[model samples]
Target: MELKLDTISKHYKDKKAVNQVSTVLKSGVCGLLGANGSGKTTLMRMICGILTPTSGTITPDGQSIYQLGEDYRELLGYLPQDFGYYPDFTAKEFLYYMCAVKGLSLAKTKQKTAELLALVNLEEVANKKIKTFSGGMKQRLGIAQSNINDPSILILDEPTTGLDPKERVRFRNLISDISKDKIVILSTHITSDVEYIADMLVMMKQGEILLTDTPDNAAQSIVGKVWEVEVAAQELRAFEDQYMVANFHHEGERVRLRLIAESQPTENAQPLTPTLEDLYLYHFQEGGTADVSTD
Candidate 1:
C-alpha cells in the first residue's frame, strides 16, 4: 500500500505549521525527525485525518483519505505524542476499551485483548491499573492499544520519550518487529529512536520537509565533516561557540567533543564517521539553515 502526501500544508493564522510537504511512504519504518515546534506533530495529525490540511491532499493507493472516511481510519492506527492514558483502567480493560472505541465486536475484543497484552509483554500485569505502571509499561500498553485493530499503517509520536535506556531498546525492538509488512511512521527528535530501525528518514525543519533519505545516506551527506577533539575542560566553551557541537564527554580532566564542520575544524581535530545524531544536531542549529525556536 502506498501512502502519499501531496504538497501537504497546514497554517494557523500567522504560522505555517507544515509547508508544502510531499512524500510517499511504503511498508517499513519511516522516521519523522524534527525538533519541537518544527511541525512534525501537525503534519502527523493531518496524515491521521484528525486535522485537515490547509492545502494539499493525502491519499492511500491513489484515493483521498477524506473521501475514504471510516474506511481510511480502519487501516490506520495512531499513538499521539500525548497519549491519553486512563489511570483507572487495567491493562486488559484498557485494551478492551480501545477495541470498543474502534468498534470491534465483543468476541474480537476479547481475543485481541489477550493477544495484545501478550504481544506487549503485559500479560502478567494484565490486571494492573495503568496508574501503577511504569512509563515504559504504559507506552507498551499504548502500542498494544494502537495495534488492536491490526492496522496496516501505524503512526507513533515520540513513543520512547520517557523510557529508560533498556526500555527504549525494548521499544525500538518492538517497533522494528511491528514494522514488517506495515508502514510505521515513528515521529521523534531522538535520533537513537530511528538510527537502527528506520528504513527511511524524513527530516523536517522550520515547518518544512528538509531532507528524506536512508539513514546511511543522510549521515554520509556530511562525510568528512564530522570531527572529534580532546581539549581541556576550560576550552570546551570555546569549541561550543565555534562549532556545531553535537556532544561532549568528560574524559578525566579533559573533555572529548564531537562536532560538525565544513572542513578540518582544527589542526588536531580527528575526523570521525558521521552519525544520524550529528546530522540531527547540525540541522537544528544554524549549520543546516533551520531556526530551532519554538515560535
Candidate 2:
C-alpha cells in the first residue's frame, strides 16, 4: 500500500501548523523528527483523518482519505502524543477495551488480547492496574492496543518520550520488529529514537518539512561540516557565541566540543563523522531550543 501527501497545509487563525508538506510513504518505518511545535503532530493528525488540511491532498493509493472514510480508518492504528488509557483497567481489560472499540467480536477480542499481551511482554502483569505500570510498560500496553485491529498504517507520536535509556532501546527494537510489512510513522523530538531504527526519516522545523531521506543520507548531507576541538573550559563559551556547538564534554581539565560550521572555526578543529544528532543540531540550533535531544 502507498500513502501520499501532496502540498498539505494546515492553518490555525494565524499560524500555519503544517506548511506545504509533501511526501509519499510505503511499508516501512518512517520517523518524523522535529522539535516541539514543529507541526509533526498536526501532519499526522491530518493523515489519520482527525483534522482536515487547509490545502492539499492525502491519498491511499489513488483515492482521497475522505473518499475512503471508514475504509481508511480501518487501515490505521494511531497512538497520539498524549494517548489516554483507563487507569483502573488491567492490561488485559485495556486491550479488550481497545478491541471492542475497534469493533471486534468477543471471541476475537479474547484471542487478540492474549496474543498482544504476550507480544508486548506484559502477560506476567496482565491483570495489574494500568496506574501501577512503569512508563515503559504503559507504552508497551499502548503499542499492544494500537495493534488490536492489525492496522496497515501505524502512527505513533512521541512514543519514547518518558522512557529511560534501556527502555527506549527496547521500545525501538519492538518498533523495528513490528514494522516489517507495515507503514509505521513514529514522530519524536529525540533524534536517537529514529537514528538507528527507521528506514526513512522526514525532518520538520517550524511547521515546514526540512528534508526526507535515510538516516545515513541525512548524516552524510553534512559531511565535512562537523568539527571537534578541545579547549579550556572557560573558552567554550567563546566558541558557542561564534559557532553552532552541538555538544560538549569535559576532559580532565579541558573541554572537548563538537560543533557545526561551513568552514573550520579554528586551526585545531578536526573533522569528525557526522551523526543524525549532528545534522539535527545543524538545522535546529538557531531555533534556540536545547536542540533535538541526542540522549
Candidate 3:
C-alpha cells in the first residue's frame, strides 16, 4: 500500500503552514522530525482526511482518498497529539468504546480490545480508571485505542511525549513489530526515538520539508560539518552565537561544545560523527532553513 501527497499546501490567513509538499509514503515507518510550529501536525491531519488541504490531493493507490469516503478512513489509524478520553473509564472500557465508534461488531470489539490492551502492555491496568494512570500509561492507552481497527495506515503524532527511556524503547519496538505490510507515519521532535526504527527520515522547517532520506544518508549530510571545541565557560555564549551548537558539556572550569558549521570554528576543533540530533540542528539553525524538494 502507498500514500501519495501531490503539491499539498495549507494556509492560514497570513501564514502558509505547508507549502507544495509532496512525497510518497509506503509500508514501513516514516519519521517526521521538526521543531515546534513546523507543519508536521498539519500535514498529518491532511493525510488522515481530518483537515482538508488548501490545495492538492492525498491519494491511496492512485485515487483521491476523499472520494473513497468512509472506505478510506476505515483503513486509517490516527493517534493525535491531544487524545481525549473519559477520565472515569477503565482502560478496557475506553478501548471498547473506541472500537464501537470505529463500527466494529460487538464480538470483534471484545476480541480486539483485549488484543490491543495486551499489545500496548496495558493489560495489567486494563480495569484501572484512566484518571489514575500515569502520563506514560495514558499515552499507551491512547496508542491502544488507535489500533482498534487494525488499520493499514497508522499515523502517530508525538507518541512518546510522556514516555521515559525504557518505555520509549518499548514503544518503538511495538511500532516496528506491527509495521510489516503497513504504512506508519510518526511525527515527533524526538529523533532518537525513530533513529533505529524508521525506514526514512523527513525533516521539516518553517512549514516546509527541508530534507528526506534514510537515517544514514541524513546523518551523512553533515559528516564533516560537525565539530567539538573546548572553551572557557565565560566564552560559551559568544561561541554559541558564532556557531550552531548541537550540545555541550562542562569540563571542570571550561565547556566543551558540539557544533555544526561549514568550517571549523576553532583551530583545535575536532570533527565528530553526526547523529540524528545533529542533523536536526544543522537544518534548523539560524539562516539554515532551505527547502529540500522531493522532486
State the lDDT of candidate 1 residue by residue for 71-165, as single tens digits.
Answer: 99889889987789789989998888888988889999999999898888999999999999999989999999889878999999988886788
Error of 2 at 18 (Å): 0.8
Off by over 4 Å in 3: 287-295
Model 3 pairs whose backbones collide: none
Model 1's number of clashes is: 0
Local distance difference test scores for all models = 0.88, 0.91, 0.86
- What is the overall TM-score of model 1 with all chains considered together? 0.93
lDDT of 3 by residue, 1-295 (tens): 9889999999998999999898999999999988878999999999998899999989998889878999998789988988999999999999888888878899999999989888989998999999999877888888788877778899999888767777777778888888898899999888786687999988888888888899879998888899999999999999888888777999999999998899988899999998887787777776544222110
In model 2, the clashing pairs are none
Candidates arranged by lDDT, highest first = 2, 1, 3
Please list the residue runs of candidate 1 whose C-alpha ends up more than 4 Å from where it truly belongs after superposition.
Answer: 249-254, 286-295
lDDT of 2 by residue, 48-85 (tens): 99999999999988899999889999899998767899
Could you tell me the TM-score of candidate 2?
0.96
Off by over 4 Å in 2: none
